[model samples]
Target chain A: MTPEEEAQLKRARRGRNIALALVLIGFVALFYAITIVKMVD
Target chain B: MTASANPALPAEWRDFFALTKPRVMSLVVFTGLCGLLAAPGTIHSVLGFTAVLCIALGAGGAGALNMWWEADIDAQMKRTAKRPLPQGRMKRTDARDFGVALSVASVLLMGIAVNWLAAAVLAGSILYYAVIYTIWLKPRTPQNIVIGGGAGAFPPLIGWVAVTGEITLMPVLLFALIFTWTPPHFWALALFVKSDYAKAGIPMLPVVAGEAATRKQILAYSVVLLVVSLAPWWIGGTGPIYGVAALALSGAFLALAIPVALRRAVEGDAMKPEKRLFSFSVFYLFALFAALVADRLILGQGALS
Candidate 1:
């Protein structure tokens, strides 16, 4: 692959990774949301 | 990826991993854990971990089977064109055999090591995803994701069954929450990947219904998911902590969905909001399930007996 294509691939991989992180964050936060509420109760 | 005859090459390892759909498996396992945590009874430590392991392996097995079956069509989609099967790093028959082995072995392990209820659920999940979703619903209709969504929703129910040895309203509600979430979540991906679906001759909602219809359905489903996510709290399955957090997150999810639903269909950018919703949807399910676990366990709502 050309340098530009490699850069593009890197960018795409980054985006997918970011997307994955967003998924995990949501997952964790959902639990936290419920947990935090319970902590107070 | 260039296939090498070298036994220790890093590239071949990737093929094996890709066949399992690791990202999807992570989500499946997490949800399964949440189900196990939220069930209204005690589970032995060894049995708990074994149930989770079997679920993870079973999910991975089912995913591998999906790739093996869809290898031909996968090469046609940009998002999936480079998968191990399409890239020829893994042979189709090899993947199929591997999937079958894992599927049966996981079920057997779960049955003997954990509870039969959990094992049955796990076995059903594999069949639902590998056969019902992949082979039946996907190609036949635009509502494919709707029906196929059940496969993803099985984790919590299965997890619950792992502990209780039976089905219950609470886990079923959790299952419903994820089932409702899948359509909107996937429709968002479908919006952006419509061209890929179209090119591959797959009939996703965004492709068949057009942007306007897709957006409408997304918003509609989001509204329904928001309501469903909140039901656990209202129905007394979860405490107020879960109720409040689930409601707030559902509101945020809806806020994100509203704009996508209302946005004018821009030519190149029609997919932007859908993409955002897709990104958020992943978070939505994870957060919601986590909250359920947290409230029950950490906050002492009902985590441990």
Candidate 2:
């Protein structure tokens, strides 16, 4: 692969990893909140 | 610089996001929120947010699946050639898997967090759009949009059921409103983009039935849309706020539709009336649904019986 193509692929992988991390964190937080609400109700 | 130019490079996160059809999701989210708000009941703000989120996620999943399924057709069409799958930015398998994951997660989370009925309806809407409309109807029939309109009509019903925990007449009227409105709205677009659909080999009404027949169908659907839009008010479900808004909005809709219906397009014609009707139709639905929620919240109308 060309150096530029490799660099671009690296950037895309990094961006996807960060987005996946954020989504996982958000999912966990949402489930926790839902559980608390259910218990209180 | 385009993703298609470098196949070895992985697609950026934004490409996956684009698969969700975010612009369309915005309308789905809005109508779902309106239905939840207009329903005569109270829900915790968090649960309300969760319900809307599930609706948005379900829509996103369905859209992703649609792109995955139609990638070949999309590549052939000018309007959809730039999509991630069509442009070679994402693998079809990745899109299909992403769609399945989102669809499953949304339904499960809805059932766990909200109610089973809402979750089941959400699942059904996904299947309706992805399987029934995309796979079965779109390629085979010119009447595809007519039957497929039911898929988009479910959001308000699901949202209402989320709150009220039962199907009711008011939500059914909302469903009917969208179901009737889709043909005119879609066919106006089809008239203008007839060449693109024809190139893709999709049997859109304008492509299969000819422009005159499609325009007449648009007018007929608009007439039906007028009655359906006003049904909530006529049934005493909403107050004069929504009733008056429906009258004004649908009146304008029919007025714009008339010129598009009556005039035949000549060679080199701009299709201005058809374009105008398409734009107004989107605004009409948004405004009509917004008025429904306003009638409930501002006028303090009780829940529909």
Best by lDDT: 2
lDDT of each: 0.81, 0.91
Off by over 4 Å in 1: A1-41, B1-11, B299-305
- Per-residue CA lDDT of candidate 1, range B1-305, in tens? 33232222223444666788999989999999999998888866556766787898899899999998999999998889878777765567878987898799889878876678889889998999999889988899999999889999998898889888988788999999989999989988877767788988888888888888988998999889888998888888888778988998889989999998887666657567677788988988888888888888865535333
* Residue pairs in candidate 1 whose N, alpha carbon or C atoms collide under 3 angstroms: A26-B283, A26-B287, A27-B286, A27-B287, A30-B287, A30-B288, A30-B291, A31-B290, A31-B291, B296-B303
Model 2 interface DockQ = 0.73
Q: Evaluated with DockQ, which candidate comes out highest? A: 2
RMSD from true fold, candidate 2: 1.9
Candidate 1 chain B has its poorest 10 consecutive residues by lDDT at B2-11
Residue pairs that clash (backbone atoms under 3 angstroms), model 2: none
All candidates: TM-score: 0.84, 0.97
Question: In candidate 2, residue B268 scores what lDDT?
Answer: 97
